[model samples]
Target: MDVIVNAAASADGKLSSRRREQLAISGADDFARVDRLRAASDAVVVGVGTVLADDPHLTVKDDDLRSQRREDDRPGNPARVVVDSSGRTPTDAAILDDEATTYVCLSEAAPVDRRMALADHAELITAGEGRVDLLRAFATLQEEGLEQLMVEGGGELIFSLFEAGLVDELRLFVGPKIIGGRDAPTLADGEGFVSEFPTLELAAVDRLDDGVVLTWRVDDR
Candidate 1:
């Protein structure tokens, strides 16, 4: 099982300059590739901010992909997981619906009542405090028969995972347009660029229809 991150950002490196929630600049082909990636993964994970801001269904909606996701259980769609340190995901969010098997990972400081409420709708895992412990999250998912986790994230999630050496592969789609926002978030933040992880190295690069794709691997060394 691997944790793969897929995302598109502006040439100037802002994923969303329009709003924190809106990815208004990605091209249609990027969307298709994203769908394909989702179709292939065993589970999809994201930070709570993405869940709260986007409220995405996280489903592969092409008719064939949809059918493939629903049949045979194991071969079907990936379960949905969210990293929610505060346990603040909305009760009405699509992840809470039973149609998608959902899991929420919370930090130790998250309140018991909130965990209980989430348990009413989804499986709850308590990781360490301040951030989600992705290693433990993966172990929990493995127990549920999920492999090949894809993380579609807000900035913090991506940075933390990269820092923790939990990421196996990273897929970045660089959109053609440049957004010169002063406060835009990078996939990794601040001195994060200065501090190298134990074994991260470039794997491959390709140009997509409207963006460039960069694939990286966190080597075991």
Candidate 2:
């Protein structure tokens, strides 16, 4: 399974802008690109924090795009995969309520009762925390037939993957508005957070009217 990072941030690197209440801050092109990325993947993933902050449907809603998502080659909306590291994902989340398939990647430490409850419909995988093992989770998903995985991260989960060298590609759309707060979250920790990320080679750079979109592959090798 290949992990792809798909996200949007403020020009100043804040994930949700300093306001943290409005999502309209994300430019049109960035939102479009995110949906396009979802159309191309087998699974769309988000961390628990994102679930709470943004109750996204994670489905392509555009009329034409809906058909495109249901084609033979790249058909059907991708399964919604949530990273609920501690089984803390709200049981009533829209992601779980929707008719589409849903999955929860949680830690082994999750209570047996909680695991049983979540397993009612959503598949639950015990990917431990701190040193949470993403490799095992990826292997499990691959065996289950998921190939391309797009991760729409919050913070911690993104940092973990980059630090673990599990992220293969990154696509970012940065809006121009400067929501300047001393403490705003960035795109997990791609290159300069927890530690210096393995240098990534730029793949594409396009400037949108009020934002910049960047694409990169981890090294040419």
Candidate 3:
């Protein structure tokens, strides 16, 4: 599967404040760009942290875009996927709405009751023991015909994807604002790399809104 990781951060590289609340880092043009990216993907994935923090619908926003997907014999919106290991995703989350198919990835350790509850709202995929195995989950997604995946993430998930060597492209939008806080989330924030970092080939750069967009292709080392 083609995996694209996309995010917007402040000039200082913070995704949001230390409070972990949702903040608008990109402008209208960037928003439209993201909507287009979503429309082109087969599934849009995010971690449970992002769903709890942002509650994003993860749908193609443009009416014409939805129409185009339908005309192309695709769903009006791509499937919404949540990498929730312990089934922490709220049943009432926006992604659980009937707008599109929802996939909740869970680990074997997830509570039976929680799994049962989520099964009513989403298709459950078990791929690991303690934590959701992203690689295995994604393989299952690919088997289900989701060939192109877009990941809009919290830092931990982004870090895991890179650590698993699953990311293919990185599109980052650096906005003009500066949100300075040591605890603030950045583009990739898990146990950061200490040795061989993932190499990226600079592909393109373009000015969008008041900031700039940098596209990088992950180099196979």
Candidate 4:
């Protein structure tokens, strides 16, 4: 599968505030651009933290943007995926809404009853032990026929995917504002890298009204 991580951060590389909440970092223009990407992808993924914080619908909003996919004989919206290792995702979460097919990737330790609860709204899959093994999750998604996966995330899931060598491309929007806090979230946050960091080759850059969008090809070299 071709994995692309789409995220936006402040000038200081903060994604949210100290409370582990979500903030509107980008404006309408960048959001529309992101919607187009979502509409084009076969699957859109996010971490459970994002669901807890924002409870986003995870559907393409623009009728015009959605119609483009339908014209191509694709689903009006992409399959929505959530990485909830502990089966913590709520059944009533917005992702469970009827707009799209939802998949919840849970850890092997998830309780059977919890799985049964979400089964009505989402197809559940087990990937790892205590936490989701992203590589295994990707393979399961591939086996299920999702070729292009777009990850819109909180930090931990993004870091796990990159650490597992799954990311192929990155789309980053950097806004001008500065949200300064040591506890603030970032683009990637997990076990901090112990060795050299992975490099990304710049593919493109666009200057939007409120921010700049940067595209990078993950340099596996």
Model 2, 1-221: lDDT tens digits are: 68899877777777765545535556666677777778878888888778888777788766577687766555467888887766777677888865578889887777777778778769887776643477787777788788999998876778877877778999888886677676566777434554464788899998875878899987732
Worst 10-residue lDDT window for candidate 2 reads 189-198
Q: Which stretches of candidate 2 lie over 4 Å from their true place?
A: 17-22, 73-75, 129-131, 189-196
Best candidate according to TM-score: 3
Q: Model 4 off-target regions past 4 Å?
A: none
lDDT per residue for candidate 1 within 58-168, as digits (tens), equals 877676886776675554567899999889999899877766788899989898889888888988888888767877877888888887888888788888777666788
Question: TM-score of predicted model 1?
Answer: 0.89
lDDT of each: 0.80, 0.76, 0.96, 0.91
Global lDDT for candidate 2?
A: 0.76
Model 4 earns a TM-score of 0.97
Worst 10 residues of 1 by lDDT: 189-198
lDDT accuracy of residue 135 in candidate 4: 85
Model 3 poorest 10 in a row by lDDT: 212-221
| Better-scoring candidate (lDDT), 2 or 4 | 4
**What TM-score do all the candidates reach, one by one?**
0.89, 0.89, 0.99, 0.97
Q: Provide the clash count, candidate 2.
A: 1
Candidate 3, residues 60-109, lDDT tens digits: the string is 99999999999999999999999999999999999999999999999999
Q: Report how far residue 154 has shifted in candidate 2, in Å.
A: 0.9
